[model samples]
Target: MAVVASLTDRKSVQPGIQSLVDLVSGGMEQVNQIILSKAGSNVELIPEIAKHLISSGGKRLRPMLTLACADMFGYQGDGHVTLAASVEFMHTATLLHDDVVDESDMRRGKLAARKLWGNQASVLVGDYLLGQAFKMMVDVGSLEALRILSEASAIIAEGEVMQLGAAKDIATTEAQYLKVIEAKTAALFAAAAEVGPVVAGESAEMKKAARSYGMELGLAFQLVDDALDYGGSSADLGKDVGDDFREGKITLPVVFAIQRGDDKDKAFWKRCLETDGIEDGDLDHAIELMSRYDAIADTVERARSYGDSALKALDRLPAGAHQTALAEAVAFCIARVS
Candidate 1:
């Protein structure tokens, strides 16, 4: 409820993302059509499970990034739409898989597909969506685009595996955590943005710039989400506050708190995280420790640093409305916590 309320308030003050959404509305409509068309199947369960998550209230930001990046380069082809759908499918598949892996009950403010349907159904449907995604990519007929996305898929899986190994490990270093997110999250963002330039036949420099922008933006996005898990309300997060804490996730705030804490604080983290012995008031204590060490603030500052890198990445592109929207998009990602 608080996340919803926060979203309502944010809508009045945040026009940056809205501007980008509006700018890409026509293309998004096409992407939506493609998504719906591709999500259909002869088996009723496939569409049922796929539509459950697809119709959920995610911003579809990755696909929008694809559309905007291609438009920024003055691409006048239908390839962007198909590629955008591919990006969305890839994202959706990951979400389904991630929820299962995380044992999460909620996603986009609804019961996770794994909770409603069995994990097997969720995973199989996710695979189906991925299959459709690759088909769409091949339809685009750009070997380079297909290659980038396919590589990203493998990297994302590796990231998830890395997180599995690192979960509840209080000793996880900042570097290791960063590597996990870079692979798990930023890779897709990078690939999504890069393919736009690839489809448009843009130069290597422009493609690299777009990829850099997406990578940094994604880092900022996930960092903000990490900070919000402790400080943000359920409405602001779309999931319960402290979900990461409950899951014993080794997020940036947790890492910072551990690093800055005294021996007693380390003991506390070990009890709650390493052993998964969380109890009432533990989340509050965790938040208090994070606040004492300025962990949340420091995390937001780090996100701001990444946001700056994202903006700088845009410098390589010629000035245009799409470019402006993309820059604003980066700012918006960091602004969620602010």
Candidate 2:
């Protein structure tokens, strides 16, 4: 009888996200258990709505980062598990809120919670998850962790408001868009990575290194997602390919294209984005213009630069499988676009 190699071994043919997932699988299992347990509620509607999105096939990358960072610091306590779950709950809450705000129809390749349960339930359930998340953080007895996460929560809310104002505004600058994503997406990631070392009693320098790694990784991840909006398949995006375009989101591609476009191209963007006067062929034309201006390629190049930063951030940490896997994770994020 022939014996088959483990999936991890096969995946090791190339160093990528799967290797990171394998490295952190033990801790991630604990995090998953905590996430499922805490996601339950006495109120029937809460679990129903929460599960709709929770079970939806997100990579759970943020929580996994918390687990990996803690493990890298030799943390053996259960605090990282609880904190990882808390990070995920915070993320899920934001997603529920985001779908409602964006008026999105799908999430993770399925109908959004709002589409099935209405905006009220989505918002309320999001609130409930957030409350539970805080409860867990408090239970961990890590005051510093709680402070970091709470601040991230406030920053994320601010980012949402910033995005709301920037929407359909073709004049939105690249700096403004970067600011929006830094708050909305990267803040939680930084907090998640930072808290791991805090709980592990690691040095402040190590904590800063972890935080830097996560922030740069998050930026690269979002930039790739933004570029993929115009160039990737729905299978890759887990939502409609042109959802950002339809929503009048001023992503990096749009920013670059607008900056470099001529008079006719600017007018076209103004109609499709600013006035919400999108026509049938507008998406195709928008893609054409973005391609003509090399917007997608430039956005991808920016993501790669951030990916480089993330790898450098990991250089401060001690050498180990976890650190190597974390660096590979950064490579994997950039590879998503490639």
Candidate 3:
């Protein structure tokens, strides 16, 4: 525990999001305003629950990606702002639904919408937010952007369903779990970045670059998160540590641990996750086993590989302050677990 803990707490010299935030702050203001205005509804609970998660302290990274990608390519219209807000709405809607689906009690260091308002209200508000997201996308009037986002939405749902099917199934393979995160997490990231060039009328080559950067960055982001579930504090994830283990999620590290662990270890995982028979010391034991097997270290190593790929994708774009900030964003994301 101490060794992994030390690694997570070690100082990261990598660049942070300040550059990215400075670059996108003006546009993000517009995105925020649009978000608040569109979140309103006649139904009181809708606004209540929607605002709860919306105002939570997520980095707003996906929307920022939209703004940065568009700005880097000189997108001059306000359409990018609308689309950024739409991206955020899509993300918020997913979080709301995810909390319900994962049976989570917390989000962003706060009570989950489902915890405060029932699962039904949380789900309905999530639906409302999704509807709002599409309406905003339609208002942008880019059929290509609309198509990209709509398809991403469907893929994300499929990822969720796939995850539901995989949960607590310790037999879940590493490749299968990657498929889940690629769909559930990376799809929106790809769409968020690709739509920027789609709306900005950049060449298809640039669109491909942006999508690849986003998809790779998203994979690194989620891989880091999987590692952090055991190695990081609640502050890093904005949720209780070990939530994945408690939920029986077959994250990358769990896959590695299971493959490398012995029969006694297999029984332990089955009891804690498969059968929900966790005891007081189980989380510590889980972390110990993961450490013994280098599961967490290997997961972080895989994240760096994806992070490197994200940087390579960035190299395909024009070099400038925006490009630099976007590049630093990848490093910053991976640094979260450092």
lDDT scores in order: 0.90, 0.89, 0.90
**TM-score computed on alpha carbons, candidate 2:** 0.95
Model 1 root-mean-square deviation: 5.2
Which pairs of residues collide in model 3?
none
lDDT of 2 at 314: 80
**Poorest 10 consecutive residues of model 2 by lDDT?**
1-10
Per-residue lDDT of model 2, residues 240-292, tens digit only: 99999999999999999999999999999999999989999999999999999
Q: Model 3, 86-147: lDDT tens per residue?
A: 99999999999999999999999999999999999999899999999999999999999999
Off by over 4 Å in 3: 1-13
